[model samples]
Target: MTTLSIYQVSKPHRAILQTSDIASILKLLTDAGVPFEQWPIRPLPQNADAAAVLSAYQSEIDRLKAAHGYTTVDVARVTPEHPERVALRQKFIEEHTHPDDEVRFFVEGSGAFYIHLGDQVVRLLCQAGDLISVPAGTKHWFDMGPAPHFTAIRLFVSPEGWVGHFTGNLLPGLVPKLDSAHA
Candidate 1:
């Protein structure tokens, strides 16, 4: 299930709002200038390659590209067996901002995106079929958990793909991780 939790940046222990309702999540995120939606899931082989994954969602990818001026699209898959899971998690767990919108569609598994806005932080737990677009320059961090396992389709306006500008804020470390936030 998908969950959304809002917390004060200074007080990470308690959430101001928490719910698993999709409608509420969409409304809240939309009000916050974040694009949150769901797309129908497509069946794919267990070990589908990037090309295969892209082919499965070609229509949607084309639509997003046309709508958002996205110039690049790719698939990212990470599993617990990945040798660099620890380093990859550390890299994304810190607060960072992108030059362009950070868009992603979850095709398998789940991950949590912590979006920092004003005094509140929104923890969005995204599962399969969920698509989230974080506007450019938004301070946020992603928690793929200790043993990450997910397959996501990422879109970028720039062909350079993901380039993070770290905020150097320790707030991400203070907040609850994916498991705790989901609970």
Candidate 2:
């Protein structure tokens, strides 16, 4: 299940709003000019290969590419047990923004995306069925936590690839973490 929780920049305990309803989440995100959605997730058998996952979502991929003018799509997976997970975390833990929109659809596992909007932060917990598109220049950071593990499909408009422009602001730690409660 995907969860959307909005909070004051202060902390998760200071949540301004929280919900698991897809419609409410969509409406709230739409009203805020952020793109959020839930796609019908195809349940793959355990150990299903990446090709199978991609094939299952091909039409949806085409639809999104046509809708958003995205030029390419790729799958990414990260696990806390990966040898370089720590380094990867260090690379992306800080607040950053992209030159183009950061769009992702999770296929498995979960992660937290904290988006800074005005004085508030939206701590979006994305699971297997979730899709979130953070607009270009929106301040945000991601966390897979100490035990990170997730598989996601990424859509890109620029062939140059995903690039992060670090803001040098470290406010994510000040916010609430994604935990059982959020899940």
Candidate 3:
């Protein structure tokens, strides 16, 4: 299930609002200029390769690519056992922004995106079949849980791939990560 939780950037541990309702999530994010929606998803067999996963959404991929003038598309996955999982998680968990839109479709597992907009921050818990497009220059951070496990399809306008410009603000360690029990 998809979830949306809102919190003041000064107190991320306490959620001002939380819900699993899709419509509400869309409304809240849309109002903030972030695109959040669900796309069709069909189950893939165990251990499906990246090519196979992309093929499953060929039509959607083609449409988005043409519409956005995306020069490259790639699949990125991180598992609990991945050696660099800790480093990878640490790298993105800090506040940052991209020069181009950060687009992702969660094909498996889940991840949390904390988007800072003005006085409050929106923490979006995105699951499989969820599509999130963070507009370019939006301040945000991502957490893939402590024991990461997710495969995502990433679309890029530029072939250079993800380039994040980190913001010095730490949000004051107020943000909460996925707990070990959940992981």
lDDT of each: 0.93, 0.83, 0.87
lDDT of 1: 0.93
RMSD of each candidate relative to the true structure: 1.2, 2.1, 1.9
Q: Which runs of model 1 end up more than 4 angstroms from their true locations?
A: 181-183
Best by the lDDT measure: 1
**What TM-score would each prediction reach against the true structure?**
0.97, 0.90, 0.94
Candidates ranked, most accurate by TM-score first: 1, 3, 2
Residue pairs in collision within model 2: none
- Report the lDDT tens digits of candidate 3 across residue range 1-183: 788888886666778898999998999999999987688887899779999999998888898888878778899989999999999998998899999889999999999988999989888889999999899999999998789999999999978999999998968257667662321
Give the count of colliding residue pairs in each prediction: 0, 0, 0
Sum up the clashes in candidate 2: 0
lDDT of 3: 0.87
Candidate 1 residue lDDT tens string, 1-183: 999999897787778789999989999999999998899999999989999999999999999999999999999999999999999999999999999999999999999999999999999999999999999999999999988989999999998999999989999877888756333
Shift of residue 176 alpha carbon in model 1, Å = 0.4
Quote the lDDT for 122 in model 1.
Answer: 96
